[model samples]
Target: MTTAVLALQGAFAEHESRLKELGETVIELRDSDDCALAFDRLILPGGESTVQSKLLKERGMDTLLRRKIEEGMPTFGTCAGMILLAQHVDNGQGGDTQSGALATFPACVRRNAYGRQLGSFHTVDTFADMQVPMTFIRAPYLDSVEDSVSVLSRVDGNIVAARWKNQLVTAFHPEVDSDTSVHEYFLRM
Candidate 1:
């Protein structure tokens, strides 16, 4: 199956490498034309959410992407990607950014809830019974998930991973690690 990884920004290359390592055909989605390509799944890598969202809309691919996800395209979002897919974003304190979000997943996310890039860290955790290393760079944690959401994994008391329908998201970057289990899980979904 072909998987399209959003290449507009962030660690798209790293995700591409991991997906290829798993023996899957990968496509780097950039514009509307790339969005039109036939693919079984999509990956939104960790990066600057505001920048990615702005680019998506400025390039006129935002609506198309939202349609694809709504139509059941299995998607995996990491870090900033999770923010893009979230229905609401609590910008920490008590404010929200309404524009530019894809709003596919029924959840409220808090951007940079773990602080800035300097607050970045790495940790090993159990995901689906398999030990995996997660890298968090300016991560955005899920503050609240709707009833339709399934909590996948958590670090400390914060929700880090979850799934809603065909969409799966993580507050950490699994692609930055050597392990391919997280990508494998998305492929399975």
Candidate 2:
């Protein structure tokens, strides 16, 4: 199946490489026209959420993407992508909230829940019942989730990954790691 990776920013290249390694046709979606391409699934790569959100709106892709996800498109989002899909977002400072971009995932996310760049680290965590390498870079975590959401992985008592219907999200970057299990799971979905 063809998978479209949002290429406006962040780790799209890494995700593209991993998907290619798994023998999947990859496409980089850089604009609204790219979003119109026929793809079986989507990967919203980690990046600056605010910037990505603004770009999506300015490029006329926000509505289309949200509609696709809402229409049951299988999607995987990491880090800032998680923030983009969340129904609610806490900026991680004094409980301030920010408007989400897609708002298709049924969870409340906290931006920069683990602090800043210096707070970034790597660790192996349990994901979908298997141990996998997890790399957190200025990540955000799910502060809360709806009952329909299934928790997939957690670190230090914080919810880092979850799945709701066709949507899967992680606060950590799986494409940056050597493991392909996460991408495989998305493929299965």
Candidate 3:
């Protein structure tokens, strides 16, 4: 299956590499035209959510993406991508007014909930029953998840990962690591 990775900014290249390593066709989605391409899955990689959101809207791809996602496209969002997919973002740095979020996941997200860049960290966390080392760089954490959301993993008493329908999100960067366990699980989903 083909997976479209938003390459507007951030660690998109890393995600594409990981997906390719898994033997999956990868597409770099930059603008609205790229959205027309046939793809089975989508990956919103770790990056600056505000910047990514701005680019999507400016390029008129946000609307198209929301439509596709609502149509049941399987998506995997990491870090800032998680913030983009959230139904509500408690982005302490003022509300998301300029470039709004996709609001796909039925949850509230606090941008940089893990603190500043100096607050970045890494740890071996259990995800889907496997111990994987997660890297968190100025990541956001889920404050609340609705009943429709299934908690996938947690770290330090915070909800770091969850899934809702065909959408999955993580506060850590799995693509930056060598382990493909998480990516494999997403493919299986």
Candidate 4:
């Protein structure tokens, strides 16, 4: 099966490389035309959520990609990608809220919940019952999730990873790490 990585912004190349290393054909979805390509799965990489969301809408890919995801296209999101997929987003500025991009995942997220870039750190945590490395860079943790969402992994009691049906999300960047366990899990799904 092929995997498509949203390349409008962020660490798309890293995800592509990881997928290729796993012997998967990878495609980069940079515009609406690219989104029309046939792919089995999708990966939304870490980056600025606002910028990525704006670009996706501007390029006319927002609605199309959302439809694909909602139609049971297995998707994996990391960092800002998780924010894009969340149904609700709290900017953490006293009730400031931002509209979700795809909003396919049924969860609420707090943007920059870990503070700024300086707050970034790395740790090994349990994900899908496996000990894997987690890299959080200005990541957003899931403050709440619907009953349909399955909590996958947490750091310090905060929900950092979860899965809801065909959607999988993490407030950390798994592409930056060498471990392929997370990617393998997504591939299997």
Instruction: Give per-residue CA lDDT, model 3, range 1-189, as digits (tens).
Output: 799999999999999888888899999999999999999999999999989999999999889999998999999999999989988888686665222368888888888888899999999989978999899999998988898899989999999999999999999999999998889989988
The Cα local distance difference test for each model comes to: 0.91, 0.94, 0.90, 0.93
User: RMSD per prediction, one decimal?
Assistant: 1.2, 0.8, 1.8, 0.8
Model 3's lDDT to the true fold? Answer: 0.90
- lDDT (10s digit) by residue, model 4, range 1-189: 999999988999999988999999999999999988999999999999999999999999999999999999999999999999998999998977665899988888999999999999999999989999999999899999999899999999999999999999999998999999999999999
- Model 2 C-alpha lDDT per residue in residues 150-188, reported as the tens digit of each score: 999999999999999999999999999888999999999
Model 4: CA > 4 A from native: none
lDDT of candidate 4 at residue 44, scale 0 to 100 = 94
Candidate 1 scores a C-alpha RMSD against the true structure in Å of 1.2
Deviation from truth (RMSD, Å), model 4: 0.8
Per-residue lDDT over 67-161 for candidate 1, one digit per residue giving the tens place of the 0 to 100 score = 99999999999999999999988886657456326889988888899998799999998776788998999898998899989998889889999
Compute each candidate's TM-score over C-alphas. Answer: 0.96, 0.98, 0.95, 0.98
Each model's number of backbone clashes?
Answer: 0, 0, 0, 0
Clashing residue pairs in candidate 4, if any? none
Candidate 3: clashing pairs of residues: none
Give Cα distance to truth, residue 60, candidate 2, Å.
Answer: 0.3
